[model samples]
Each structure stands twice: as structure tokens, then as C-alpha cells.
Target: MKSKLFDYVERDNLVFHLSGVTKLICFICLTFSVMFSYDIRVILSVMILSLIFFKVSGLEWKQIKLMVIYVIVFLLINFVLTFIFSPQYGVEIYGTKHEIYRFNSRYTITLEQLLYQITKLTKYASVVPLGLIFLLTTNPSELAASMNRIGLNYKAAYALSLTLRYFPDLIRNYQDISLAQQSRGLDLSKKEKLGVRIKNIMNICVPLIFSTLDRIELISNAMDLRGFGKHKKRTWYASKRLKRQDYIAILIAVFVLVGSICISVFINRSRFYNPFI
Candidate 1:
């Protein structure tokens, strides 16, 4: 049977033509843009741009549906909880509040808090696409090569690559184990209480842990037999030499960094939004 867990996200798409460093630089730009602003307009703009890139990357809609669902659920839960518990959170951002509802002297809902929550949600949404882009577009081997080019040790780079490579394997293993247990009389799918489900998952975890350890030992032995890591510098079959694309990638990163710094200074000095208040 095909393993679902280690199923590498492969695509013969345009994104693959961009060197790993280029994708990495783009990721850093998007991340900084998300984190460096509390402005909802900026965040939303970044998000929209990221979505355009996602389309350009040629990722299947069906493959990303689960991630989309998770993001929506996370945003909903975050905003709901923040509003319920800290509706006065807008005091930090707006320096004032417009009361929406007053339950008591200590409990109230305000426009400021609601807007603050929305801004926070927008920030998260901005970063989510970039995170997904990095994960979906970069292959494990290429990512390792990028890391190595950036002066990381081969061992460390390869370990990082292996971790990414094995994630799908681990997920597939868990699913197979769960299925086997279910076929043998486990009822994990039942709508039991949350606590019961937790207990059942724990039960599954024990065997999964042992199985993973055995697999690890087998892999280690095989590597040792093949003289893995014996050399001071191991050659990589998949590693690529840095080219013109990599230089352009680094140049882009420098431009983004400089631009963000300049914009931040301008905003702080001019206080452009001060006139609105």
C-alpha cells in the first residue's frame, strides 16, 4: 500500500524553478510584513498577495482544504475567546473604547476590543499563507541544500531534512495502527466523551511510540552498516550549487529588510495615523 504520511508534496510547477533560497527569502519577507504591522490594511494586503502566490505555486485546492479549515477554526476560536475574556483589549491599541455592551462596572464589550481582535486575526491570516507556501513549495532535499549553503553543518542540515521527510511517514504509521486497532475491535470513531477519546488516543500512543523506536533503531543500524557520517564531510547527491538565482534571492532579501526598516522609521517619526485621531 502507498504510504500517505511520507507522501512528498511533489509538483512539476513553476515554483520548483525558483531556487530554495528564493522561496526562503519570500517567506521571510511575508513573515516580517505580517509581524511588523498592526495595521489591518497591511495585513490583509499581504494575505491577498500570498493567496495569489499560492495560486501561482499550483498547489491543489483539495490538498490545501484541510489547512484552510484548520486556519478558520483557529481564527474563530481565538477571536471568540479573546472577546469573551478580554473585551477591553482595544485599550492598548486605540487608547479609548466605544462601549458596545455593559454588563457591569468590570464587564463590558467595546468597539476598540472588537477591532483589536479583528486586527490580531488579520495578522495571523497574513502569516498563515506564507507558512503554507514554505511547506508546500520546498522539497526536503532542496531545503537541506539551502541550509548548507547558509553555512549550517551537513549533519544538522540533513537531520532537519530527515525530520521533514519522516513526518509523513509518522502520520501514515499512526493512521495504519489506528485502522488495525479498529479492525481488531477498538471503537475509536465512537462519539465518546472527550476524556474517553483522550484515553483511547493515549492507548494508541504507547504502541506507536514503541513502533517508532524500533523503526529508528532499524534505520540507525542500516546507516551504520553503510558507513553513514563516517567521513568528515559527506557528499550530497541532491545538493545544488548556488547560482544566479541564489544571488538574486539574497539581493531580494536585503531589499525587503532595508525597505521595512525605512517604512518603520517613517511611520514612527511622522505618526501618519495621528491625524485621524
Candidate 2:
């Protein structure tokens, strides 16, 4: 199938047929589970499971490569800053410190710190894939319809749909505008100095922003002509009811969430599992 402006949601696969609302619901449960629990084992399992699901969905790594790279860089930055500022944060949280190295009066490395940071990274690793899976495997129109099905106002649902559709379009428009700028003698190539390349991009960004605004106005006018949001409720031509697979998926997600909460509260006696104790 041809890629749309909403290319993330335009893919075809077994997961593509699942109800959008079900994916959102299950994703929420899984995300919450990962976020609330600090167990390394649980976090690792969730991360592995999410990657397996992503593989099963038949999405190409090439399609999501840039986004994954951005996430990884952000996470790495967080990791470095955590060590720079709060070197003892994990020790404090875990209530135990086995010092691996003492750098100075204020800076020391500990095994507890390593484990804490790993768990933190694992939390991010698990959640990012779940979010990517939802965005890439579900249809945007169906997602909007699912929002409306679950009691969100039609206006809000429509707005959400437009936002989802707008991002990919914006990127496409940026590329087109950059090419036009290049034709007009702007040099944005890597051969240019960093400062010059930035200036070239700024030149491209100005017209791209204007173009985006014009397209937004056009969409608004078209919707106005069609009498969008004239009714409190709207029908969705593409929406599907929850299916057996969707139910099973949702149940599994909920079970994971509840199980994490129970283990954290009852077994671990806290969100953090202190092996050092």
C-alpha cells in the first residue's frame, strides 16, 4: 500500500487489524506497569516482550530508525546526567551502598547505583517500544474513531486525528521546501560549515512554517464546509468493535499491570528491589 502522511499508521500486518481502542487501552496498562515497578527482572521481561511484539507486527526497522535513534540519544543523555549530578541517588533509594570506586569527597560509584540506572533505562526501553508499536501498527482514522467510541468529544477526537496526520505531513513539506530552497541556491549540504548549514535550515524552516499554516487553514475551511462537529456524536465508517484477540490482549496487559503492582507492594515491599539488603 502507498504510504500516507500518517505513514506510521498506514502499515499492513496482523496487528493492523486489531481495534485501535484496544491497543490504546492495552498500551496504557503495560506502560503503567513498567513505570510503576522498579524491578529489574520485570522491566527486562517487559522490554523483551515489547520487542517481540514489534517483530510480530512486521514493521521494518528502517521505517522507525530515526525515531529510535532520537529516543536512544535522549536516554543516553539522561544516563550521563544522572551520574554527574546524583551519583548517590541509587544508594540513597536502595538504602545500601557497595562502593566500587571512590573518586573524591563527593563522588563515588556503587553497585546499587549501577542496578538502579539499569532499571531506569529498562523502564524507558520497555515503554518506548510499546508506544512505537501502538503508533506504527494502528490506523489513525480508526484511532480517532476509537477515541469517539470511548466517550471523548468528537471535536477532541477530530483534533487528535488531525495532529497525528499533521506531523508526517510537516516532515514531507519540510523536505519539499528544503529542495526548493536548494534550487534557489541555498546550500544545506553537510559539505557546508555547521553554522552555514544551520542558516540554510532556518531559511527552509521559514517558508515551511508558512506552508504548514496555509494547509491548516485549508483543512479547517474544508471541515467547516462539511459541517464538522455539528452533532454531539458522529459515526465512524472505519471503526471496528473489539474482537476476541483484542480482548485477550487487553486482559494480558491488565494482568501484567496488576501483577507488577502486587509484587511491588507485597513481595518487594517497595517499588525498588534492594538486592544489596
Task: Quote the positional error of residue 170 for candidate 2 in Å.
Answer: 1.3
TM-score of 2: 0.95
- The lDDT leader among the candidates is 2
> What is the C-alpha lDDT profile of model 2 across 253-274, one tens digit per residue?
8998998999899999999888
Give candidate 2 misplaced runs (Cα > 4 Å): 1-6, 9-12
State every prediction's TM-score relative to the real structure. Answer: 0.83, 0.95
| Model 1 clashes, total count | 3
Q: Which consecutive 10 residues in model 1 have the weakest lDDT in total?
A: 268-277
Task: Go through the candidates in order and give each one's C-alpha lDDT.
Answer: 0.72, 0.85
Per residue, candidate 1 scores C-alpha lDDT tens digits across 1-277 of 4343334577776666667767777788767866776656656767887788778877766556667888999999998888778767676556776787898876688777766777789888878777777876788888887777767887788788888888777877788888888788766766778788888888788899999899889988987899977886666566666567667755754565555555556764421122225
Question: Number of clashing residue pairs in every model?
Answer: 3, 0
Q: Cα RMSDs of all predictions?
A: 3.2, 2.0
